[model samples]
Target: MFFDILPRVGLKPKDYILKFILPASVISLLLLILGITYFSGYTRLVVLFLPLLLMGSAIGYPYIELDSQRQKINERLHIFITKFGVLSITDLDRKELMHLLATEKEELGQLATESHKIFVLIKRWNQSLAESCRFLANRSPSSQFGDFLDRMAYSIDSGQELKEFLHGEQDIVMEDYGEFYKRAIYTLDTFKEMYVSAVTSVSFFVTFAIIAPFLLPYDFVTMVTVALLGFVLIEVLLVYAIKSRLPYDRLWHTGEKPTKIDLKLKKWLIISVIGTVLFTLFLLWGKFIGEIPQIMKIPYQIIFALGMSPLAIGGYFAQREENLVIRKEFNFPDFLRSLGDSVSAKGGGMTDSLEYLSSNDFGPLTKDLEGLYKRVSIRVNSQKAWRYFGYDTCSYMIQLFSEMFERCTFLGGNAGVAAHMIGKNFRKIINLRKAKYQSVSQFSGIMYGLAGGMALTLYASAGVANMVNGLYTSLDIPDTMISIVNIITPEDFSLIAYLIYGVLVIYSIVSGYLIKLMDGGHYQVSLMHFVIMLWVASIVGYIAEVMTGSLLGTSLPI
Candidate 1:
């Protein structure tokens, strides 16, 4: 398996052995010897595993790289194939189409690299397209991509029209891609269940640790620290698991040129940072100084909420832009179809077609469409103008399909057909995104509910324990019974409170990022959820403390 993957990853067996395996083996041997000579007991055991782990990683590196490449290709295969079909409808022949695709490194990613390799084989080696496709098919890391290549080779040899073959392949590939996408979502759902179960278990453990001091001789802080560490590890694993399974559906275009929205987002981000720093400083000063106002001496929960409040401004703006992008994406298919029809009707005059469509309303996309028309009409760089339009909309899909539309029309392809095909596939992806969004929305609600429940349970347990300790302190019990009870003290409760707060912070941060992973949104957009979840947990904790204190007929220190 290792040798097979090495070739797929472009490494010869001898070279891989000489460059990686030999060096790794020597290092592993030396490490194992050193560990045995220098370490003792459990430390020796841990060090002993280090060499084995290192050797395992060295041996598996090629397979890992191969899988990474396979995933990258498979993730973007659907979109690449769709774009390929659109471009195949144009006047560019097979080689030209391949070269053009090879140039689109940003949009196609690894697929572009593969396309460039194929182009090199055909251009440099004078191989026929069919032979080149077949040659590459054997070595391709992705089974799906390899299968497509195999089929393309047969179609080429059979003298089928490239456009028609791609049109058929598009449907087949998309259907497969849909199944692949659904499988990813199913994995996400399974991970969500796993996450809930794991977190609940950790919460129970934490509660047990908080109350354990009354009976067990274990160090309370140490026990809680272990639980918190375990909780963090679980969250990290879940984040990684979900991220690995998520589809490569990006919302924002990754262009070098900054859009107006990008600039505004940056401005708001700066404001948020400045405000957070200032607010945090003020809170820290109030905390350290004895002259803090009585009203400002609220619980840490409120303090955290206020400190994070400034971030919401930037988050809200980013979220609004994200929504605006979705809205524009929804209207993009119609815009493309209309533009295609116009271009065809006007005999391939892109500027004239844009002028005609500029008068039409495309919902949130109308203004950007007008801007595109104006730029192209004035003979400004059409590519830059369309790029700006895409950036203005902040939709990655629009950038891709619009670029395809512009390129195909410029090549004198059947504009109406290209538009229809692009629009149809674009709508399919949008529908899939809708399904994903619905799933994430439900998951969001669950996360919020979980956060509240966790906070309440944790704080309520702390409150009840503290109240019990207080009650025991106020009792006039005999010395013998008092010694046997091993009651928790005020200082212990304070430590537990701090530990619980730490847990809440960790949970809030992890859960917020988890939501972002499921939805495939920008991390900055996740700040809103983080702030909201943090506030929910904090407020719930505060309420739990107050309610528990009242129910226990005690005035707990606020």
Candidate 2:
């Protein structure tokens, strides 16, 4: 009711300062937002929440816009299906169209998120489905499916009757589409896992942050060692996160190759920042405690500097290589099964059928198979053709299919059975993908727990320092004086045991949350949110240091 009336009021917020010079900030901001909402009758109501609303909308926009777009695309698909009906292509009715739309909405929506490669896959799927439906009406008009291949496509391409020439390809294509959708689901599962990983990491990070610093005086060597190791461990977690989010390389060779040196430099810069922060903390401990010496400090710093450089280079190359392999081999197994089935069912010789079906160019599978047929047609031995298929096909199915063909001499003896087995194994590959996602979730939890635990520990240690310094002031002790309380039992030294215990709890919570996300849920980003816990700990530590240093006349340890 307010929405209908507010829009007609024509309100707006041109300047908050002008509206609130005499008023408080919140009141002025509220009035400005309300004004915007009031005028939204003629526009959008989005301006009302200010930053909060903006944040909410920003997060919600993907679902809302994608769903809205899906409805429009579904409508277009329905209309396209109707056109097939008019032309007698497919016998699919409204129910069939709705079912297709539902599947496509789920499948495509999952694929069409932030990744451009995924977007391409979805668009191609929709385009192929639309084309197939449209073509079915013209090709096999009398089959009760539609005349998609014969009348319409032949008229357009003015070529031979592909439907007649490539008879029985329809069922194979349908089977392939089902397999494609399955892979899409497996990929989407990883997204859900990431959210869980993020949450677990945050809780653990907060706990860790509050407990770290107190571990220092117990053994600065152990303290620095743990802290430095944790930093490297967190970097490894970052790498794992990147891998889970993207199945392939971060750089896809979209255009000219990017400078590898530049990327390596960027990675090193990040590593350097982490190293600097850690080393500085250790240096402060050595000077204050009169414990750290050049022998240990110099070598530790130098080793990190050298080791991190190679890690940067190796990591970048490994990511690129892995992604390229996936990119080249993606879905080749399924494509081959479809080709093999189409060839066998066409009631022709193996070589002829392979030659005929090669026109589809479904993927790298076709090109490699074409090599086998082309060589054999020229009187190359069966082994030669088989070897070519093995050499060119990058998928695991390559060796399996080549062996099957070579043993039978391409005589089509149980090739269908072998292809079916190959297809079955491909389906299992999807399961492997899901399992890796579970592994990623587990790994993310561990890293989050480690980082959070460290942050929390440092925070608590700072607070203790502040209290100890305050004691010196209250007792009117001199700057150089050593308190009996500290000599007998330093607070930092005692806290080490508790901090170590906290690490175990942090790990469990992190792993549990990641398990939840990977299984599926509306989980928040655990890693990013975990940063907030660290920030809070850092703040508390800073305040503690300031209070203690002021009271006891000691400089605050950074």
User: Backbone clashes per model, in order?
Assistant: 0, 39
- Residues 1-558 of candidate 2 have per-residue lDDT tens digits of 322222122222333223323244455477566767576653434454454554445344434543444333321221222221221222343234334433433223321121222233335555333344354333221232234333333443554332232223333433443443344345545543554454445434433433443333443325434653464465447435533433221112221223343355356546644755665566655644656566244422232233233333333443344343344345555655665576557653667766776666655455565666788788757676665555454333344334443443243334554455444544554354455556555555554554444444544444455455445446755656542323213444335323432443344334433433443321222322233333333333344445544655553222
Task: Give the per-residue Cα lDDT of candidate 1 at 209.
Answer: 76
- Ten-residue segment with the worst summed lDDT in candidate 1? 287-296
lDDT tens string, model 1, 155-240? Answer: 98999998999999988888878887888788778988888888888888878877786686676667777877887888898888
Please identify model 1 stretches exceeding 4 Å from their true place.
283-297, 464-489, 551-558
- Model 2 earns a TM-score of 0.34
lDDT of model number 1: 0.84
> In model 2, where do residues sit more than 4 Å from their true spots?
1-330, 342-359, 364-412, 435-453, 456-484, 487-558
- Which prediction has the highest lDDT against the true structure? 1
